[model samples]
Target: MTDTTNTDEQDPAQAEEGAIMRFMRATELDTRLLGMVAALLLIWVGFHFFGYFKNGFAAFLTPRNLWNLSVQTSSIGIMATGMVLVIVTRHIDLSVGSVLGFSAIVMGVLQVNILPEYLGLGHPLIWIIAVIAGILVGALVGSLHGFLIAYGGIPAFIVTLGGLLVWRGMAFLIARGETISPVDSTFALLGGGPYGAIGAVGSWIVGLGACAIIIFLAWRGRANRRLHGFKLRPMWAEYFMTGLACAVAIGATLLVNSYPWPKGIVRRYAAANDITVPEGGLFISHGFAIPVLILLAVGVLMTILMTRTRFGRYVFAIGGNPEAAKLAGINTEWMTVKIFALMGGLAGLSAVVASARLGSATNALGTLDELYVIAAAVIGGTSLSGGIGTIYGAILGALVMQSLQTGMVLIGFDAAMQQVVVGTVLVLAVYLDNKYRGATK
Candidate 1:
């Protein structure tokens, strides 16, 4: 009986050791994951409080309002994805907003006039052409910036800053200072319409597919690492994280789609002798935006490129130690150029989406876009000195910026105050990031 009791005590201790080991392994597997999640939760809580104090609890997490917030976030979020790559490589592209604006204007022109008249395109087909054109234009602009930066010895910041002005000027020239009104219905659909509804559905499908692919890849990667005798997180912990990620994705989708139709309505009585009339209210889904899907796709692709590719590794090397990377036979210059080109292309895509949503292209379309993009990247944890960053982090940063903008607007903050607040946040984020890095070092 004494021997049996001793064995029982040993078993419990063993179990506790095992549990502790598992927790430690998980903590090591993804150190930043918890912090990132915590940051997001904190942002939500802050927003919730702001809404509650200003407009009561119901204003917080209204389904329609949530959907609007997502849509508003999409545009900047998409650009930030590309900005992540540029920042990871210790570079910046200040011209992205201008590039976006230019691309959008071009797409609008094509959709409204060129496609219908020259290409004989239908509604959806016109949208396809516009998207294609936007991407191509973006790529070309990026390549130009890359060429100047990589080969001409021009700083990326300078080149892109010049590009910001050049492109804005070009936009004015293209649209002649007029707000290219009466955008094609087809093009409008690309911004956020019924196609946007289709886009939301598409987002779910893609998210699921991405989750599956990630799980498979992660499992295979773990197996390979183990086989090669590399350090790896335990299998169960990895699976748990993967499951949790998938659940979050699914939950987000459901939450965004939960609002009732005809979200708000109003009634009017003409006069004492006149009859009353009821009119259907404005629905949030009515403005459901497709830009969100585009941003998601861009984010996913950027994450894959950053985390899974050799090019991504080279980017880190270049950022961390350019001289060392060059000595090690990495094509540093070419890579820089390529990165810039890629950024330009992304800018173009963003511009197109924004333009479509606005249904017009104007000289002011991309003004100060570079500042926002740069701020987003820096806030997302991309080191200004280069080397360490993640695409997902940039996306999060962009979302935070977007949320701040949205919340401020909802709370009736003016443009000047918004700018002041954003600038302050950017400074604070940079200070915190630098402090964290210094402590870690």
Candidate 2:
């Protein structure tokens, strides 16, 4: 009656202004991050096309390679998210690697040695309790670091440096210079090898679920922005980007799902174990590793905590100007403690994933990983000086780092070169951040 169709068509462009503006703002803020993403994709393509063999697909781009690459990145990816929060608050956690080793040892000891003798628990329940114990041990270590830095007023670097030694020593005491292995099949799945994989079907389900959630959130965010009178991108742009994202998501799922397991290998494997073979020639695919899912979950939580909550606001405020935040009545010290605690928690999760993946626990479980985690965070565009970072970017940074490592392996390059390249990348990232900040000032 009131030309409603015409009105709708006419106002649709304006209606999406809020979403468009927000997207643009984020893009502008994350220009470097976008560039890093592009760089990662380029590496993926380049390594396959240019490096080593003239194989059908680039070596690194193969389904098995990609699947393994993702799993390799998972542990550090989890830590990188938490490192984002710590770096955002202008703090650092130098002991995460050691804590990971110590906590992992705690988990392993509980599952293999302690439980059999004392609790006599079996299967899923023991696995569950062991993981919780690992996490708790990690939190305790984090709380101690937090207290020392926040309450005792010791410098964060110094306090965490001390923790680096103490935790590693504890791990040594736990393991006594021996590798502990033969973990339960269920417990081993957490580490993400074939035994730990969710398989192809499970991977598809997870990927689809993740994609759906992302799209729903994007739509809801746009609607909220429009309601709040914020500017947004045009509807066309939103749809285009969203479509692109969905395409990538589905493509990734297919790639992982299509990696063919050798028929002979499956047959022999079944035969050796006297297991029944299905009619469809094994009907199996290694979909996604559970650790990847865990990393995704941690990444999402970190992203939300850093972007959507009061704690996030305070973190930025304190990082930007501690004195000003304190003047504004924020509990800066306690917040610092909490941030470190979160970092410790993620490190604990990393231990769980790493220990599970290896099917063993050793004192050297997390050796040098603190450096890896820090470098990933910095390369992802988390500022060392603080007040800036993103969990997604940090996770991507971990991916990029692992990509380089995996590519080198595929190409048969010296593994030691990884440290050289990572060091260079890290130095370059710090230099760029400093330059950008200076230019801005």
RMSD of each: 7.5, 6.2
| Error in Å for residue 252 of model 1 | 1.0
Model 2 weakest 10-residue run by lDDT: 20-29
TM-score of each: 0.84, 0.88
Give the TM-score (vs. native) of candidate 1: 0.84
Model 2, 1-441: lDDT tens digits are: 665455453477655679655565443335666678788988888788866455444577778889889899999999999888888888899999999999998888888888767656565678888888888888888988988899999988999999999999999997897787766567888887664677777878888987898699779979998999987767766776677778888887887777656677678778989988888887567677788888878887877888899998898888888899999999988897788888888888899999988888888999999989988998888888878888888998899888888887776668688778767877876787678768757
Could you give candidate 1's per-residue lDDT for residues 321-429 as a string of tens digits?
A: 9999999999998998888878878887777767777777666776777788888777888887888888877888887787778777777779999989989989987
lDDT top scorer: 2
Best by TM-score: 2
lDDT of 1: 0.75
Colliding residue pairs in candidate 1: 100-351, 138-345, 139-345, 142-341
